[model samples]
Target: MNTEPEQVSLNDLAGLPSMATLVLTVNNRHARRILADLSAMLDAQRQVMALPDIMPVSAWLRQAGDQWSFASDNGLAAHTVDAFGALSLWRQVIIEAETDHALLDVGNAASLAQEADRLLSEWQLEVPPALQTDEYRRFMVWRKAYRQRLHDMDAEDGVLGFERVYQAIVDGKLHFDFQNLVLVGFNEYSPRLRGVIDALRAQGVAIFALQPSQVDAAQVERVQAADPDTEWRLAARWAQSCLRANPEGRYAIVAARLENDVALAHRVLREALGADGTAPAVPYNIAVARPLADWPLVRAALCWLRVLRAFLLHGRCEPSLAGAALLSGGCAAHVVEAPAGEQMWLT
Candidate 1:
């Protein structure tokens, strides 16, 4: 996904999220590659979260195999230990094995968890009481297992993987380890993706927003059919989501939709990125979209995630891993940050 040989300094205004703090990514390999490669590049004092589930820091250790790291939720390591248990060897090994076997950075809510209730409840969705207990049990098991790994790691690392990654990248927030926090799942930006973006901003971390390329041109046409105001709102919502996620960092979002109206595209994007960090903006960038005619090629992408998921459970990844790796490039992104000066170190 990182095309350039040297570090790709993404100076793109439209592609980067303005005044945001964390970059919530979905692609597994790029996330891993970025995290691992950047970990050393970042100020050691700051936190650089290596998503154990995503491409993790442990992946680089030849001798460590799948037992060197731990998986914490929301980058909060202590809570995970409290919820799961003190020593979770099985959970620790699984998280490590899954990462070693394959590198996936996305957090898919639908299939990842055994019990749907735990996730839905977190989303603030109402679940049937009858199902809550069952889901709660499943959630408890998963949470407990998840925490077991955290208890094994350095306690200060935090429980959220998103936080860990963000802490690693920011310039000013560099003091302790890049409180690399991992914001779990794309759902965070789905329906209320805008709200999610806003929320990340509130967190105050480095933001990396990604723009996805269009898998279907028809979808773009449908989007164009909506009123300009509605379109602007949608764009604004999209931008807000990224801004919120990465208040201090940069973010990348792919406007993968296709259309010829460059002017309208600009207006839509401006509305999305907003003006001041708070919100309020105009046309920002030329909303460039990526288009492909190959149906199979496109369909394969939608399924690329499954390949990563499979690799997580089993060790061998599909041949599709090559193509799946490119999805991030197909999109655009926005970034925000403080002036980078001295390397930061955490207390």
Candidate 2:
């Protein structure tokens, strides 16, 4: 409640693309040896995390009394706080398909297909282009011709089990959020994984596209065409209002809190309006409809919400941030709104 201006870092982070997860696999001959190395990781357990409402943007941020802790929503017992790195491994799968895509392999995939299953099973990996299946034949043809690559660098000790790599991510305990979800480090597997990304998006989850590190062509076209849903254009408008030096700089696709999230919607507004500034005054117009007669506290609240409108729509209601600045001086927001029958517009 201090009169100081809200720090930049204090802003809400609701929407943003998250970092990506990876899958790793090794050659078939090394499967047994790799499994032994992974045996040690099996003891590490997964802790369940809960999603909470009424909390800042994430349930993880909600503090319990004086203690910082979170409970599980899925009825899974709470264990030691999960290391973010380790948690990510569980989110993705690693498969080590043989990378050979030579033309001879393509021609022989029909004959070699039978051997794929055995080798893969021995390696504890899957031989895709399901053997004897149409996809299996198709994949064989593609592998020898249009190969789809997956990223899986060699482990320092040459031990490779996708499960072990996933466990390593969980134990890493790195910072993560949905925005950090991206598709990176995978090149050859892009085409097939493209399908996986599309499926996740259909479920309302925005994930990295098949091309990874690239923006959605559809979304970009919509924005360039100035579609209303393409709020990318609005970014510069909001940034200009906030007096940001380079509005486009904040246009990163991956961010913790973006305007799309309902939770962060009015936060900037409330902060900016309560602060003082010589901002452009609301263009005055006599409301012939309202008759200017309203209740006491109700009228006061409406006025406050209107003040909030400026900040919300424009990103900052303050006339000048460096000058008197938003939220400066001991003050509280108080204002009124027009009656329900009529809608009002700001100047």
Candidate 3:
């Protein structure tokens, strides 16, 4: 481990070229595409899987859940792993859910689980039993089987995946030629990524971490009143200010959390900042979350599918709901000529 103080400024690396390579997690791949048209990407998710124990608890749950339909005790809903901190949080949530199951033993179960987790941590092991019961036995059985399959998949994909980048760094095959690496709007970095960054810094590569500027506390509360998720809003406002400050400036939302927030913030800020409510909309460079069902094509396809299925199964058309699904696209388009050719029906 390097003992030197972490270089906080890009200027520290003297004589290094000012041009930088932006590194990002796989979720932000879209944003990176916007920023660097030609820059190569190593999927950080793939790379992080090099550590088998840390190989995303979500993946484990998916595999295990598929094999045995072990529903969570409290119906723990599935969610997207968009943020870095979510992995550990999800693991804890799953364990807690397992502990809460009625089938699991209740007598000193929590204390036993904590002790088991502490022992596993001390021994550098991955398995953490949540209860001393038959359910725990069943879970371990499934986990052992699932882990083998997961490991096999990791082996097949490991070579070309992000894991290669970390391996190259470890093997002294990966080295940066540039002097500066400026991370823009990255809130968190994985341990492997941090290691790679440290290695680059050790070799005189100046790293500068850039974050979105925050509004004052008074402004923050006011903005939160309008929209509770202030992180994206403040970012949107900053972007709006940037464009206003410099007409040529550009803004990119990289791996933004809560996809809805990105669009909402953009619309709100753009209208507020634009003069006479007629300014150009916020430039969202990356693909943000918008509902696919909202699209005309998707809606039409869904409507047609639903109508055809209904007619085939029930031998009748539910016009009220089906008509709504069709919207302006007339029933004529959906109607298919019957086999007799004398009559037509929605097929």
Candidate No. with top lDDT = 3
Better TM-score candidate (1, 3)? 3
TM-score to native of every candidate shown = 0.24, 0.16, 0.35
lDDT of 3: 0.45
Worst 10 residues of 1 by lDDT: 334-343
lDDT of 1: 0.40
Q: What digit string (tens of lDDT, one per residue) describes model 2 on residues 195-305?
A: 333443444443431222234555442234355333433543444454444423433233233434323323333333233465432111111232232444444444454
lDDT per residue as tens, model 1, 72-134? 222333433322232223334435545544425323321244234234433446557677785
- Candidate 2: regions farther than 4 A off: 1-133, 140-230, 244-347
Judging by lDDT, tell me the better candidate of 1 and 2: 1
RMSD of each: 21.7, 28.6, 15.2
For model 1, the superposed segments whose C-alpha errors exceed 4 Å read: 1-24, 29-128, 133-196, 203-210, 215-347
Candidate 3, 1-347: lDDT as tens digits:
65333333222221233344333323444344323422222255433211101113124223433332243332222322322222223233344455545534332343344344334322334545564577467545434433343344332121122333444454454554456555544456645556666777767776665333354654332333354556556766767777777868765545336574665665656654556555665444545657776686776765676677667756987776475565535346444532323332333
**Model 2, TM vs. native:** 0.16
